[model samples]
Target: MTPQQRARFFDAAAVLFDLDGVLTPTAEIHMRAWSELFTAELARHGVQQQYTDEDYFRYVDGRPRYDGVQAVLQSRGIDLPYGDPSDAAGAETVCGLGNRKNAVFGETLEREGIAPYPGSLAVVDRLGMIGIPAAVVSSSKNARQVLEAAHLLDRFPVIVDGVVAADEGIAGKPAPDLFLTAAERLGVAPSHAIVVEDAVSGVAAGAAGGFALVVGVDRGVGAAALTDAGADVVVSDLAELLPAEAEKDGS
Candidate 1:
């Protein structure tokens, strides 16, 4: 890493991470689940449109589940009632569709399991060694489950995820509420914390929150897009943020 890049980490009081694409490959699973849900739903309703990765990036990625459902449905000029969270998966309501997607995600996660990215692990390890705190700030209600599946639940003591967000009435990404909540939980000011994310919405949240740095991981999201979304720096992988000495030691 460049000296300037190294200083970004060293000078921060804490690092807040987005859970899915940033730290784990579960993002692919999420994409599949979303595609499955939307494809079937669109056909059933004869919407004459197909769900695609572009839709996922534009309307779903890094946003709260119900919000994503609403956004995608709005894109197709379809409207549904804002159903209760307890609604059945088969119900034709916003929360119901969101619940349906989560069910598919849960099934896939159970079937295939998950693991953390090696580069993300390396970055976390180095942060641990340096005594900088780390927390997770994700829009997924399944953040804890994903972390536990990857055997990383114990690493982050401060997790502000969808469940917590709902319980606390916090807004989701692009509003900065979730990331700001995490920094507060860690007792670090937003100005003293770094935000690491793979979604444009998450990067925008970090920027909106005035974080010390916003590091975007380009997991299929182009570097230029991330930069345009307000990332201070963009790397294809978290390992690229490691210092030269730490990189050699890991090697």
Candidate 2:
């Protein structure tokens, strides 16, 4: 869809947003933590390979942690023990490695904190003005914490994040369950809801969910990659998508 088409779709029903790279400015932090943990883990096994920024967004940005571990390792043609979540952060098991990465991410969160993308927040505020409900679909168990840190928690009333997805056994992005759940919670039909995602897998999920609009937030990824992965519309930031409505209202 073009920006006009996307705007037409958002004129009614709801918008479901991916939390990390879409609403918050912490995608870089996640990429860093994942890179560090995976690098150290591979080193312990004497692999000595590198995990790049390209690797992080492609394999894990919107995914659950354990799933992310599997994805990245699979990308590298390496496999390790599926360690327990209870295992020490440095432990070599997959779960252990994931936990270690979380510890690193938590520390980073504490040190750097969370900041909502100004452009994305503008879009959300616009939705509020238009009386369109919007919620967040996140695969991070820390979604609430991240929102709180960013001080945008109250903006979304229906949150479908990692803990909810795991507890309900709903598959994550590229599967559509989380996004669908958000739409359901918002009492909106799939065709009436829009999904704004910044990750490739997330864009695929929104497409798979049959959302009326799958708007991609091209933070660092090129626009073509997001479109190829199934986004209906791609924008450099949310602000680009909001001015039309503001203009219509003389606001």
Residues 51-144 of candidate 2 have per-residue lDDT tens digits of 7887787888778889999988887778888977679977777888888888888999999898888778877877887789989899998899
Measured against the true structure, the TM-scores of the candidates, in listed sequence, are: 0.97, 0.93
Clash count in backbone of candidate 2: 1
Residue 60, model 2: lDDT of 83
User: In order, what lDDT does every prediction score?
Assistant: 0.93, 0.85
**Which regions of candidate 2 are displaced past 4 Å?**
1-3, 244-251
Once fitted onto the true fold, the runs of candidate 1 whose alpha carbons sit more than 4 angstroms away are none
Instruction: Please give the range of 10 consecutive residues that has the lowest summed lDDT in model 2.
Output: 242-251
TM-score of 2: 0.93
**Colliding residue pairs in candidate 2:** 83-94
